[model samples]
Target: SSDLSDEDKIDQKGIRNSPYFKPDWSPELLSNGNYITHFCVYKNNVIEELKGFRGDYSGSQDYDLVLRATDKERKIEHISKILYGWRQILGSAALSTSSKPYAYNVAITALEDKIKRNGYDGKVQQITDTFFYRTKYEYGNPTVSIIMPVLEDLEILKKCILSIKKNTTHKSYEIIIVDHLHKKKELESILGNNCTIIKFDEKYQNSKVYNSGARVANGEYLLFLDPNLEIITNNWIESMLEVGFISKVGAVGCLLFNNNGQIYHAGKILGLDGICSNALEGRKHDNMYFGIANAIRNCSAVSGKCIMIKKNVFDSIDGWDENLFQYFNDVDLCLRIYESGYRVAYTPYVKLQKQNQITDDFSNEIDQRKLFIKKWKHVLEKPDPYYNENLSHVNGGYFLTSSPPLPRLMTLLLEVYYERIDLQTQFPEVAEGDYSNLLKWVINEGIINDSYMVTLAPFDKDFEILLQKYSQ
Candidate 1:
């Protein structure tokens, strides 16, 4: 913006994606901060009716105006085109909130005012070291059912329960441990007065285990967690409830970290490396990669473990899918909620340290994965709406993609189409990969098995990114 010239405006897009800007217009988006002011237009009547701005909150006047305007209406849409540029000069708010510390409290005031106007008993607190804010609500201190699934690892459960009891500030929550192997008396000995136990026999890990736990849930919200996680954030439930209370959000998840304090699950990304996986695992738990780690944004899915959902929403989905015996059940649940017209959100406001997961065999998960792909291929075959198509899953980090979406898809199609054919020398410049072999193998598979996965996974997310990019 300092170089707001015609040529510079043309090149403004260079710093436009990731860690700088992403297009989100939901009330949840504005609740954290304003993304609607730069190079934006509004109806004169709307602005006038909202009473332009107050000099009292001069440092964050733009943010105040944005909150007031958006608070009036949530039916908003994004144009998905770059029309603004903000300069990150010294002593300017654009260089992060530290540039003008006064703006921080002003933004909180604006947010709390909006929350108060909405008839919610909530308080907004800024996330330290970042510009983002998190809202925590009382709602008369509703009980939250903490449903955790575990094996016979009583030691892990004990450590986790003790941590929860120590760290959690919200007292009105119950812990329901759904055990596959019987450990009732032992579980009772370790847990506190509010704890309940549910026993079940399941051969493999999946969301179905939560069904029995849900039946016994006495709380207004259901918190599905893994027994292996050590609770870190004191306000985990309140943070989740803040987002879940939003009428449009079905579920909320938080930043789950390995013992090393690295990100384990912030959310789920569909079609990463031809499979669905946790979001931003490559980044440290607190690393502000494009501000994604802290911001509460809609995700394609959040981890079923460490996810919280309203009891009503959980029942509406008929609970977790029982068909999934092992993998991707969490994603299936979130996507089903998404299909039913609700958003899944991820927040870093609540942090938990999970025991390191040792996936000795990626091959064993393939069967459940194929089933997951078949069941939710519609969503999988399209680019994740929450994940930016311009960002890539290379080297397991969300870095800028080497190429744009369209060309990437075209190149893949050419690769698959050219894999078996003797066309490599014909197109000397074309990049080569295993795409044609995959297509051919899939075709042969369809011929042999008659009609399923071969056709299901051929285009994969490459076509997904292409369609989403061009369609938008």
Candidate 2:
């Protein structure tokens, strides 16, 4: 161990030439396998199985083996320290080696056959890539107003602000704290001039409170922060802001982790088994979505903990609906934006410290039911005809509701005089696209049928006017 001779020098060629020499992942990747070293020192039953078990697959065989062993018995203690080593023995790609490819094929076939035996459908598409932030900063940093609506959790709120102040790479920003539903005394002492604290009656609704703050926000960009959330990394604001700069991006959310460091939200997965959980749950920090190092992928919707949008976008959608007090607000906003031909995306660079967690200790049935009803009314009643049951949220809820009047009018105007394609030349491209898509989606969702077509002409002028105002 004390050898300091010249012979002890690491072979630079070996280090540099090795195919597996990915500095970012090599250290942690080797550490995950270090437990093998302790096998010689301690006699363990589990070690015996691991040694005996034929993990013949390539690349991920060890990882899969470990997973299998853990699933059998979760009682094993995690060796948090680095103890094992994995050197560059071969290229990481399994198909590169004949034997390894055979092994992987066999493993995959076995897995598929097992799933078939268990009556599982193998038609699902695995999301291999995830949405991440752009490093180029193509949008350039714009002044952003970080609006936080606080109710309680003063400690976490302070931490949240501090994290933002210290970690954010984007320098031009201000924090607006909406102190409505909680005592503001604790918050008063901690806030700096960078922050503007607004007092309002305890409303308990984030939508309305956020709207109130947006009305006063002076920045070109608006970011919504929940009090319980804290920023976890540098460049978080920049990541979200870049997305906001995209003309079609309506909202952008980041990954969220709870107090325990477990992932609370990676990105929203719509149209999953009646409910959706974080994309990758309980994964160690590096083993997350982009793998051990860094990467980005797209998601359906980002978490509410940290969502950023253009100020114009916020106003264009009329901000958050005050009727939605607490829950399903984000989903509601996302749906509206999506309908308006904009995208709701999840980027990788933003890391939010999530505070709200579903816990076993407390019973929130009453509130939960209220939230469910408020959020999924379309799914429950199927009253809106534009609802496509297959389009997520409602297996049948989307088709039930009737088309709103404005959308119907626009569609009829388009159909009655197909010659008026160049009509309303004053409207912007986005405005034209928005009106067209809203009409199309409403029709596609089956909200209005042929019988409902006659009433379109009367409101065409009004619809165009509103479209200009909304999309401007």
Candidate 3:
């Protein structure tokens, strides 16, 4: 903007511009952000290539400009609010309006060029998905073979593949599609140069298809994906790859979106409300980084829809248990990974939009009460998973404990049931005496409340500080 001459401004003003100019925004007004801005728009031409642009993108010129500006050495004021609106009117040249195949061609060229430009020592040919940017020394990028299980949906699967071929930042990868019962002609026509199709005779089961793909995969890392999802960004592979490289992270997953473009899965909580619920079930993209197409975080488990695992980790864990057909396959994998002493992460950054999503499909009304009781029968049993009587309510660490929901609830219900049964009849000593101590511990820890430990008791100052810090 500083390069514009006074004469040029005057000429534009004379042509059609208004006399009044917008006030220069102050740095203070933009501070103390109540909201996070999606991205800052830089003043630059879309088609013209700027000098010193870190990466080359014939089509994503605007994107490169914005990225460059964001990484500049200035106190780039975070416009603590949505400052501008880019109005793409109907029939305008919106990016998606372009022909899909043409866009794919442009995106592929730009991606390969960028990858080669940013790759380790310019060795683009060998760069794998697992090779995130390393600062210390260049480590050998172990080849990662990704096995995607394809069903009969050729169109959705094609979009997924095109998205990857165009946007993927890592190139040292192959797509092996285990077409477990699909039309031969459609599958053959769509399989690209970089992908292979394996036909299986049996009926389609997700775990079995993935296991079949892993048997002949030649990469150092293995990535599994469901075909009904579209890859959205270049960072998808790299994001999971970085997480997978961490010693603690056994598996990595991305956020899933419903057809409406709202969030479906950020990650699943292991034990919440008697069963695991995918966190952030229905949240809108306020243009913040958290719900963006590719924000990464540590999570309980990656969804089976899309997951990345190191080859060694996969083998050591004995791969997917074909016993788990589909629904809990991902959960079983995560639990196995944890049991094998590895962490499961949920990165919101990487994104895939689920196709044929039943986002609003809760039409059938099932028995809510009966279902709830049956689900928590494990918790009603003997040993509680999270009911530590020793730890005070002030302790904030119970959420991370290994107590699965069912057993914990089962233990509580039995204790209360037995206590009430003995109240009327002179029954045996049925109530577990330890329940009092455990209840007290749960109450004090703030899991449950009791009248016994009211504010009437004097508290230690040291204890107060410790509790406050943890609680906060």
Clash-forming residue pairs, model 1: 19-290, 416-435, 416-436
TM-score winner, 1 or 3: 1
**Per-model C-alpha lDDT, please?**
0.68, 0.50, 0.50
Worst 10 residues of 2 by lDDT: 1-10
Best by lDDT: 1
What lDDT tens digits, residue by residue, belong to model 2 across residues 407-470?
Answer: 3233334433332343335223424345544444333432344322323323323454555544
Better of 1 and 2 by TM-score: 1
TM-scores for all candidates: the values are 0.80, 0.50, 0.50
lDDT of 1 by residue, 1-472 (tens): 0111110122233454333335345456568766454544566776788788888988888788777776654444454445566665567666556788988898899988988887787888887887778888766678899988775567887888888888778768898888777877777778868888777876645566788899999998899888888888787777787788877789999888877766777777765544567777856654555477778887888887689988888899898988775677888888889888888888877888876564434444546655776677556546665555656644344666556543433432442334434445534434443234334433444224633243345455444454444444
Which structure is stronger by lDDT: 1 or 3? 1
Maximum-TM-score candidate? 1
Candidate 3: lDDT of 133? 18
